[model samples]
Target: MAATAAVAVACGAPAEEPAPEAPHGYVAGAEETAEVQSRLVVADAAGAVRVLDLATEEVVEAGRVDGVGSVTGDGRHAYLASDDGSVRIVDSGSWTVDHGDHTHYYRAAVREVGSVPGADPVAVHADQAVTALALADGTVALLDRARLDEGAVVELATIPRTPHRGPAVPYEGHVLASVAEPGQQFGSGVAVHDRAGAPVATIDEPCPALEGAAVTRRGVVFGCADGALLVSGSDGAFAGEKIPYPQAVTADERVREFRHRPGSALLTARAGEAGIWALDVTARTWTRHDTGPVAAVNSAGAGTALLTLTADGVLHALDPASGAELAATPLLTAPVAPGVRIEVDTSRAYVNDPAAGVIHEIDYADALRVARTFDLGGTPSRMVETGR
Candidate 1:
């Protein structure tokens, strides 16, 4: 461990004095003014957080938590949800704050900035304004991320605990949460609320069993049994529009789980036993593909292609438009049980071989072959790669 550094940026004003002249400490591997970058955050079964540098493919930092749920990132930091019902904001220590003339690159310890309470951590806005927390009891807490950056955990609103398993999305001053139809297991509607937790509107647009959710540049979308729910607008005037599945695509075998990086316009999900669906956010469309019982997935390219891993340790790249199999790479050396998973972004695809205590990195644009492999020497139960 090293000493920590703190730097905050308040835009829209020129510096009162010229930026401080200083001797540099730990500099980021990439320049702040360069294109955006991200690092991987891995949470092991022993309740420890291990970070692997995306470039080096080596563990760089380690920390501890109660348990790992969803980990959300905003380029500058990561907010991780634990089994203990706490959300700890970990400084990714690799970020850039843009100013007019120059950008400030930063490197800090993998430290906890602040936290809030909820059984699970959900969405983090693209600009890092707020974070949403969800619980199995169907409660959602929207916390202010800007306050967390100021070393505060301010809860903006908490939707009462309902009887459904759903997550919430936060816009400027409003939140959208999925709700189940009365006495039904599927969530066919969404409840909208203001910052004060006051109900604004309830949208019933027929997206049965809403489960998978992703926030895109276009808007926030949720997966449904019949189709997807696309939410547009901002602040108090948010609108929910239903994008129904084409009549050619039936709902009986639709996927309820979608995996994607928050703020990514593209989303990928699994359909039934061996089906894959690529969602295009810009046009609000769904394209079907197959990955043969995919266990876990992370997608990119706005529904262009998908990097997927089946339950049997085989990784496949499929053409999102035509359900064509592009490539396949066997990921594991030894057979393991079901539940191993893969996470992919624009740069690389990370696959965890839990049975071998290893994580494999593949060049997605190349032949889908292993570029690097990490021998962790221990199994990592839950993992999330940060860097878009």
Candidate 2:
């Protein structure tokens, strides 16, 4: 049976008098300068890209784009991709249409591409104008960022049957994707693609049904179905380790969701359990954090983690090292489950609550509070932050 909890805060308390509307979106932290401006761009399931100023907690500008499969940004521009095989570029400064400026806005589309049912756009390279994996059609395609208007999205290459439902990570000019097959049964691996879109190598020995993967400045880390973790050095050397699956945790107790800490370790939440596990790759150890049946988990940075409890729509901030709660704030009211996805940066977090048809925002620095929410018009399946 599902658990129940009491709601503590009123649902509609008028927000502390709204801050001045930001120029781009919502600005959260300190004053915005040429170098340090609070900016975030998110893509919803309905194929729209919304830019927010983290400082002001407001939507700066929103526009329709074809299948915004994923999003990423440098410090100045946000890159968006579509599962239908297209890419849209938006200027972070003005939050307006700049598709004509290839240097700033690069657009591309793939024709006759079948559906990528459970995939998302994971990585982007602004300098090279290349966008990486996350497609449900069991393939990963890399397209040209410059001549996107050529009508035909040039397919640099494709990776097949990679069931990874997480973001693709780009490291040292190459893109890495996790491949896990359905039923959590077998045949999972990691596919490494070069800049030219060629599969250079595939690592399948350690685990299959690999659900999450992240690349750091030094190597790549991935999580498997049966509580296994794998790491590959920057030089392509592979290492495998297993995380103890709590005996008290049943088969129904699966790793509900997880996030990789770029260069450190992995944070995972198990269903039916009221805690999050921090797996240290180097030490080959697991430290469990009691947080109550987490609906979601996201790593904002090295030592900071976010835990979402679906029952009351509350999000908790944790210090992975000490298993201590740093802050807590309530978000959505509806029950969020497996399909609800979240993405975060150091200052803010974004959640795609399909049932609510809106993307909820949480301010990490401010008591892990829910600052604002936006309607997506349809069930949003995934979310990612781009351009800082």
Candidate 3:
């Protein structure tokens, strides 16, 4: 990933240097790569964080945090949210920028960028210019994305706290936020706001009890009480459409969090305890499968099986169309920790076994093959993959 050039000299004459052209999607202090530089950011409950390079198998200490309750990422930076209302940002030093027809990958030094005060951040979303962090307290904090790339946490603006639990996503030069109706106890719908935290427009869809949000190729999806709300548009003019469940669902069976390959249209989430919910954003449909007692669930998007970790600590790949068990492997010990997660990239699926202090890499396409297992030497309570 080094830049090189050859200069020619004739008769001892000094060669005139041509103007340098910046590489496409070039960022200062980062080296652009040819392939995705995938890295896993693993964190323990005590705040020890490590970045495991998927390609080199090298583990780099990304400093640490204090009282880490959960960890999340936005394809680049890992956000470690602590229980004491403080959040720390760790740049995994790897990421991909998708420009529709083309993409770019980058790598740099892994380091802890900075921290912001927000009690138990539930969601962290980013775009080209801003990062919006939605806390459990309903406050949304917006940080400058460019400064974050420079290892700094600069809060440009903040959307005041609301009564909802949904994420305020950073969309095209605006923020897609959750709003609660008067006299309502939970999120009633989504609203659009400018970067300065001022309201611009409210989507008409009444998405009561919104719990989860994800940005996909189709658009941004928010899990609603009755169904999922799909919001799509740009330039401050957006519209919402309701993708209601085909059949009636109880409160316990509703999807709270969604997982999928970054920018993929298909999403997967655990439905209550004994089922899996697959949402096809392109088809605008939801499919339910009776998977017994799931611990975690995710997929590599279209054409991949639904990868689920059951209560028995075994990983199973199920057909997304018919819910048939396609493959299975005992990846973890029985009675896995509650914070265990299944992270699926394009070619591999990863699961952390806290009890055994290892991360399992499964080849889902090859009948649940345990391709490699990296022993972390310590427990990784929570983890997220970057540089997808």
What local lDDT score does residue 315 receive in model 1, on the 0 to 100 scale? 77
Q: Score every model by TM-score.
A: 0.79, 0.61, 0.93
Tell me how candidate 2 scores on lDDT. 0.54
Q: Rank candidates, lDDT, best first.
A: 3, 1, 2
Cα misplacement distance, residue 170 of candidate 3 (Å): 0.8
lDDT of 2 by residue, 1-388 (tens): 1222223344445568877676652233322344334455655666665665655555644566665545555444455666555555555442112233322321121112122233345444332355555554455666554333222345565556544454455554666666555644333666666767567776555554555554433345555656655545456444444555544554445453456422335455554565666666555566666666677776765556645455567777777778677877767665664446566655667776666777777777777677777763555554545434
- The ten-residue window of minimal lDDT in model 2 covers 105-114
CA deviation > 4 Å runs, candidate 3: 1-19, 182-185
Which candidate should be chosen as best, given TM-score against the real structure?
Answer: 3
Whole-model lDDT per candidate: 0.67, 0.54, 0.87
Q: Which candidate has the top score in lDDT?
A: 3
State in Å the error of residue 343, model 1.
2.3
Q: How accurate locally is residue 241 in candidate 1, as Cα lDDT from 0 to 100? A: 81
TM-score of 3: 0.93
